[model samples]
Target: MALAQRLFRTKPTEQIVAEGGHGEGGELRRTMSLWQLTLFSVGATLGTGIFVILGQAVPKAGPAVVLAFVLAAITALFSALSYAELAGSIPVSGSSYSYAYATLGELVAWICGWCLMLEYAVSVAAVSVGWGEYLNSFLEGLFGWSLPAAITHSPGQDGGVVNVTAILIVLLATWLLLRGASESATANAVFVLIKIAVLVFFCVVAFTAFRAGHFSPFAPMGVAGVTAAASQVFFSYIGFDAASTAGEEAKNPKRDLPLAIILSLAIVTIVYVLVAVAAIGAMPWTDFDPERTEASLSYIVNLATGATWPGLIVSFGAVVAIASVVLTVIYGQTRILFAMSRDGLIPHIFQKVNPRHQVPVANTLIVAAFISVLAGLVPLGQLAEATSIGTLFAFAIVNIGVLVLRYRSPDLPRSFRTPLFPATPVLGTIFCVIVMAGLAGVTWLAFGLWMLAGLICYFLYGYSHSRLNTEVPR
Candidate 1:
């Protein structure tokens, strides 16, 4: 085959679906129901972002931050519809990676997979770093003492060395995933419930102290500010990709994956809007201190009730919430590699599944170890921005994939389709680009380096070993 032919060769849809479960030790077992699938996405997404987003975004958009969340949700809704359509039709472990392979070909599929690596892996590390800070707050609130800053903070920050709690949480998530998908989902459901209840409690308490005046000059910062904040808030909606990634494990993938993706986004947006309203109601947006963002939600609760206990509850909830993100994102990271490995794009180490547990044992552990090191030792302030850009890039490609597949295979069966045909996907791609444009120059530079590295790796190994021309038994 010519070089370009090999690079752009599309994987047959029938073969992609046929090879769904095969791997090194054994095939992945289907144990996830629609509920578990939905919660997994919820657990991955509903993290400390909302707890801190108010402090960070509220100042940017003022009381109209609520509108920012709505705007972000609308942009995500466009991509979510595309995700739903492709997820329902394709239904594989790779999510957008697989979708791209079936439409855009090997190089684009590999690039999409590469972007997911940055999205899931780097976000896991960034969120875990925040976990240590919340753990200290919870400890201090309940016992009047905090973990030593040295052990709790990452290296090069203050007198800190390694973030012990950050590493501990990643290791804990690794152990949970090693157990099995069903077991991990069950534990995530419990964590999700706890975090949701805590947010609800804050809403109830803040409502009593509600002041409508805070929302009077809601557009204090104008449309420009609201648009900027929406770009930041849109990242919080990133984890619904977890639902699409779980396609191979879902019991009724074609029917349930689309539902889970859309349903999870709906639940997250509702929670976000309610909490945004409550936080602003309890305190003036002008008073939101960006310096203490991670404690923003709990800080509002403390000020509202004038008690240490309520704030403590919120802090404790944050610890659980960040830990939940670590678990689910790790699961997502491993599964992406699992799909790539099976396609001969990456090393086979990721392809090895534990036959009895029906999970990628080694893949999970390796990912956890790498993420823990980043969380414990690296200062992730700038590196974390890459997560947003990488995710937006993958989403745009998926939206394009939907447009291509619909044109190429009009007869292909689809469980769900994006409404408005080309408009849906066309807008989805445009929205993704708009968000990507809002990202910082440093983020774009980092993403560029990551993609360069990925392209080099693809040519060095992936192109020669791709399974497009290789026959495998289904």
Candidate 2:
């Protein structure tokens, strides 16, 4: 009983806040303003998915993919509300992991942090591969020359040797991260504007070719297809909570974190709905080819204008957009690891901060090295399912953490609260599980294997070395 209690030890909310909570660098500054935080959320959330997912989702839901985007948005909103409430109340660095530690226990927090590695790290690697493809496309258009297939494609792709451009982009983002958080957020805001402009332009052009006949068989694949597509579209909404990860750095974390979470979702949902509606109306749903849809936005533009310049412009925008995704996702990864390290759940090296930059330099480099290798050598076409499932798992935990906190600490001053109380979190958890159930069997097996590996590490290292066990009085 004693050992069990210790293993499931929950960190007191006050201690969590007071234990050098700015993370390892006690002077980690709060430089992000409300506008910058919102832009970061918008930028991180507006990743390669909007540019790539339409092809896959359109084929699944036909013209009703617009409805699928709405459905996915609704599903994500439930969790987003939970995130806002907790972020407002806790204002911690480790996104859901820190929330879980405060409301649940160490074991759960460790698991949540481990799953985030999948959501952020692997996702960055996958997005980096995409960045390489679009970069090659842009270069081929501008200079009539592109990197060789071996250097631009991942292994098992067109006999690829290594994705050198993918590795390069990851290294570039890593260099930016080593500079500091404020610089990265400013750069991300610029990227967000470029992405929004490109999407808005695509919508305007696509509407010129809109036809009502496209709606004749809107739900051609039925309700099942809509649900399936929504499940996948959910991936497009993955990085909205990224703003929550910036809790420690926000100038007004309690107010800005919640606003950023809600506002970012609202912005991305509007863009997704408009783009989906415009794309479906502009082209026959039957004509959306999955194999050729990787460059779907550019393809849509080319079809609308009957010219190549628009497609080239969209491709250039895509290269820029995906590069920003890689940047923000990798940034989120390092912070989560830094938090875990501060709790002594990982090596101390990750928690060390560079006094000059006020950033976890070691943590950033290690994560960058690992993600770059994956980007260069791995074929991540199928890894997206794993990423989706991992995110849903984290969402489910965050929802549960909210409910637990509300019951356990009713008087905790919250800058924001889930509007419907238990209903919001309950529905959020249920929807996340339902979406997760749509994934393939292989994905579950892989997730399980990953979790098992995490547990092994916890028992061997984290359990013994955890700050909660060693420092906090039992």
Candidate 3:
């Protein structure tokens, strides 16, 4: 193939389907049902961002932070529709990477995969970095004893050598995943239910202190602030498409994956808006400090009830819930790499599944090791924005992918069709661009550097060995 042809060569849909269970190590075990897939996505999306980012977002948008969440959800809804349609049509473990390959071409597919690497790894690491403070909060609240601050916090957050608690949470989640996806999904389902209940409990408590006047002059900073906060909070919706990464492992991916994608987004949107409404109604947005966002809900509960125990319960719930985020996002990162590896874009080590457990054992461990370092040692506060930008970029690609595939293969069997056809997808792409515009200059710089590195890696490695270019042993 000429260089240009190699760069833009598309993967055939029939071949993508045929290669479903014929990867390098072995096929992913198909065990996930509709609800399990839904919970996987729920566990990923209803994550540390809402639990923490609310304090940060609220300060920017004031009481209209409620609107910020709604706006972010609206943006996500457009992408979710595209995801639902494409995931159902081209169900595969690669998620948007595979979609882009079958639609856009080899180069865009590699970039999409690279963007996913940044989105999943950095976001999960950021969440794990915050997991420590909550773990200590839960511990101190329950037993009146906490891990030494030296071990419990990342540097700059506290005078700590390492965030042992952060690494510990990642390790625990990794072990669960190593056992198998079924076990991991079961545990994540439990985590999702508990966190949902805790969030509801917080709403109940906060409403007790609700003041009608707290919402006056709702958009205190007006449209600009709300849009900026919407951009920031949009990161909260990053993992709604996580179920698509498990397509090879889903029992009926065509029907269930799209349902899980849409259903999980709906569930997350409702919970986030309810919590934001309760929060703003209970306390003035002026009191929200962006710096102290880790326990915003628990703090609200304590402030409302003037009782520490309820807040402590809230803290414990956040602890488990945040751990659930770590588990699911790490699973997402590993699976994305697994798909890339099978396509000869990365080392085959990532695709090597353990025979006994039917999981990518090495892939999980490698991803966990990098995440542990990033969470335990790095000051990741600024880098969180990078995830939002990366996610938005991938979302734009998927929206575009839907359009390309529809025109190229009109007869493709689609279990779910995006409402409004071209309008939905075009708007999805436009909305993603709008949100990406809200991100900071530093975030754009980070994204640019990241994408530059991805291109370098692709030219050096992925371009030379892609299965689309040269025959890759299956």
Candidate 4:
């Protein structure tokens, strides 16, 4: 095979476009506006991480946990800029995966898409599990009764068996996605409003209890701790870039893609910082216990304020918040797979859309099945770290892709461009690397194993079936 043929395994871009050819699938409906796209990103980005991750990270960074949130936001900003550039130029559905295929090569594209599967699919499962806990808390708060431990908690946590509630929630989201994209996005916007209101409510109540003494001895774990915690807390910011995935759907891809991404990131980052400040200041950072880290936001509010009503509201908000996260993440997962399948890198089933709904039903079902199994069986901590590693890896690739595309196809029409060019992407790469390095050895091992599996799949299936291998007629 020629070099280009080996790399892309399909017709070159010039030939493909000359023949008026795109991937196998039909175009997605371009119904989303900048505001909806921004909310989609926010809906995906804000969830369990802020409600649950703080307790785990605070012990590591002490008062410096606030600094960790800031660092993570800064790091996310770098990648968001890079994504804005590529997304504007490509204006495709697969986000970084599509951008990589167009610029990096087919093989690299497959790897990026595969890693994104981890970012979206596994993260949905992890978020669903968190949702289950909040739902149980909400139910108990309302009725003084909850599901059995075996059906509520994942296996190996508190000696539970399966997470039935989590699995059910995933299944429910799957059904909703199969209905249609417009329906899902509309419902997500509503959920986003409710979730935000709950967070604002918590901040108000928690801030009322704020004590300056709690912030004393700031940076108790020092700068090292701040960096470590920032790395872990970085996962909370993953969804902010999700707006880029809707590149093709944005009203004006070049203009709105970047705007949606940056606006969503800024909004979510502010919300997270405010919530963290309120939660920690309301109660001494030292008082946060790891064991109760999984409690509903309401529980945290109740503990801090000694009021059952605040906890009740918080629990209600968490139930809705986590459900929205699962729905949005799963939507993202199916769409990316749909893009891949249309490219002939995955089975055709992934690209098949239901005529009635115009959604990738098969892809949604497959993602939901995997996520349900994961939510039902896996531990939250292990699943969370793995998801983080996958997302960071994909973010790094998007940053690098921006630089590569700038050199390889500089004249290509781009609606938006990264402000600093090489410097911005370079900084983005470094920031992702630093965060990746902070992950535990076990997380790295899991990532390695996942990559190895991807390699095997590529050689066996993707390489042979890639659409790039097909020649376009003169």
Candidate 5:
């Protein structure tokens, strides 16, 4: 009973309302509109993962990879619904971390925030590395010059030494974020448009070369292979929930949050499925080589068409798309840390916004430095898988949090309630768990170690430092 009281209890809604109604510390501006919020979600969702994951996923499931993309999209849809409801009920910058705090208590909230570091921070690194490869390709096509293979790749992976291009991209993102959130969002919307155009172009060109025979031996590896490929492809869906994280900034979070989340996911999924169908139709599924998995989709297009211009266009699109990902992911990361610092779960530096720009400068720098090191040194595949495990675990917690909140605060005014209540959230949880189970053992070990480190930091610093522990006068 004592343990339950300690772990499951939360402050009353009255207190939560009082605290949330007023800004924490300084008056941070809420300037984002519905269009900007939607663009943020779209920008974060459509990035390097989709540009390259097909090569790795298609070889596993053949034409069945199309089904895997659909499966992953369905799973993501459930969780997006859950997020929409929670964002409306308790609009806050911390995303799932804030939701867990309101329903599950401070400790779990802290852990969720820690887990989010993997989703945003590590994801930024992984995507930045992807950007490097495309940038290298672009330069090689345009200037006929490329960085030395040793400097362009990560150490201990296929003769890479530094991944200098990845480091450069991360640094650029950090600089952009330090400028201001509103400015970054505007730039992101433009990039999102360009990226969508490029994918549509790919779909058009590839469909021209479509052949019916490519899908004949679909699922040659069977259902298990499809599920495994779905697990891998699931990483492509990570950014759909980014809209929920911007709850504090949205003008009408209740009405707009759900629209952004669902709309972004649906658009991205359609693009993904179309691209997959077109790519498969253009080439035999058996021809996909997983060993060259890091190459941009344009490389495959060039190989299939024997034309260099289409490949160059795709490469250019990839570079811009990845830059947009790094920009938006870093934005999400700073906001999350800002919420944690406001709650006293971490140092105040994360919450310190520059008065001139009203941006979380310290938080951005910290995230950029960590991402720079990871992108500069770590192999892309390892970083990508590890990011997938972390994101799926966070999604599972968010799904469970929705159910908990529905029961715990039944009267909380929600702008959007998940359509099917218990069924939707329950299915969301199960889907996330199944995908998580399919991750490699090494990825799980890395995730376990990261969680352990987070727990230690919470016990050593966050538990006692938490603002929740500080008494508020009646």
Candidate 6:
């Protein structure tokens, strides 16, 4: 009975938020402002997906992929509202993990953190692979030369050795992170500007050749196809929670986190809808080949403009866009690990901040090295589904956490609350599960195995090591 009770004991919210600054090793500097936080979320969420995912998804739903974007955004908004409320109530660095720990229990919190570790690591590695493709394209266009496929492509692909370019980009982001959070945030903002600019430019150019004929078969595959595409494209919005992970760093987390979360989602959704309209309007949906237009937006712009320069520019922007994605995701990853480490759920080394940088250097380095290896050698094209499942699982938990908190601590000072309360969170959870149902069976198998491993690790190490667990007597 004691063990079961211990397993489900909720950590005090005051303790979690209060301890944010007084880490075991050192304090993380609270330097980020509202706009910086907003841009951080934007940079993290808007990646090469808008450039690549549209081609594949468009074929599934036809021009209705625009509706797919809206559906996915609505699904994400449920969880985003939950996150905003929780982050406002308990401003800290752990994102859903911290929220779960406070509202649910130590065991659930450990699982949430573990899932996040997988989500961010796999996400950064996946973006790195896409970055390699665009980097090669940019080089080929400018210098008329590109790296041999053996080094640029992942192992097991056309006699390839390893994706050295992907590993390089991961290392580059790691170096920037070691510089400090404010520095990395600034760099990410610049990259975000470049990506948005390119997308805006594409919309302008592609609309020049827009034809109403593309909308003829708008619902080519019907509502089922739209839902399926929405499920797949939901991964594109995974980083909306990035601001919540930076709670400790935000100058005014309660005010900024919620605004950043909502604003970033609105901005990314608008960009996605416009890009979808432009892409489909410029070319027939039947011609948007996933294999042929790996860089979909760039391909459409090239076809519409009948010029190589525009495509080359789009590719260059993609390269820059992916770099920012890698930066922001890795930033969130390190912060999550930092929170776990500070709570004694993991090694203290992860929480140890560098005196000069005010960042968890060791934690960042460890995460970067692991993801670099994955980017270098693994063929992660099929594993993107795994990333989606992990994210959806996290989203579902955040939604529940909101409901639990409202019941447990109704008076908690939440700067922002989900307006519909029970209904919003309930819908969020249901929508996320619906999306998860669309993933392949193999992905579910892989996620289950991963969670099982996390449970074992928690029982062996996390349960005993956790600060909350230590408070209970043997």
Candidate-wise lDDT, in order:
0.90, 0.87, 0.88, 0.80, 0.81, 0.88
Compared with the true structure, what per-residue lDDT tens digits does model 6 show for residues 367-440? 99999988999887656557778888889999999999999898888899899879999999998898888778
Instruction: Supply the global lDDT for candidate 4.
Output: 0.80
> In model 2, which runs have C-alpha deviations exceeding 4 angstroms?
20-26, 380-384, 472-474
RMSD of 5: 2.4
Instruction: Report RMSD (Å) for each prediction in the order shown.
Output: 1.7, 1.6, 2.1, 2.7, 2.4, 1.5
Model 2 lDDT-worst window of ten = 18-27
lDDT string, candidate 3, 1-474, tens digits? 677888998989888877875555566899999999999999998876777888889888898888888888888999999999988988888999999999999899999999898889988888887777788788888899877878877887758889888899999999999999999999999999999998899999999999979999889899999988988888788789999999889999999999999999999989999999999888888898888888788889999999898889888788888889999999988988988988899988998988888898999999999999988888887666687787888899999999999999999999999998999999999999987886789989988988999999999999887876786422
For candidate 4, report its TM-score: 0.92
Model 4 bad stretches (over 4 Å): 3-5, 8-26, 155-161, 296-300, 377-384, 472-474
lDDT of 4 by residue, 1-474 (tens): 675557753223443223221234454566788888889899999887777888789899987788899999998999999998877776767887877777777888888898998888877877777666678788888899988888888898875799999999887788777777778888889999998998999999988888888888998888889988988888888898788777655667668888888999999988988888888878888888877876635566787778798888878877888888888888888778877887778898887766666677767888888888889997757646677788888889889888887887778777788887689999999999888887889888888888899989988998778766754522
Tens digits of per-residue lDDT for model 1 on 70-153? 999999988999999989998989999999999999899999999999999988998888787888889988998888888888
Best candidate (score: lDDT): 1
Displacement of residue 75 (Cα, Å) in model 3 is 0.8
lDDT of 2 by residue, 82-191 (tens): 99998998887889999999988999999999999988988888888877678888888788998788888888898689999999999988998888999999888888
Native-to-model Cα distance after best TM-score fit, residue 280 in candidate 3, in Å: 2.2
Q: Give each model a TM-score.
A: 0.97, 0.96, 0.95, 0.92, 0.93, 0.97
lDDT of 1 at 354: 92
User: Ten-residue segment with the worst summed lDDT in candidate 5?
Assistant: 16-25
**Order of candidate numbers by lDDT, starting with the best:** 1, 6, 3, 2, 5, 4
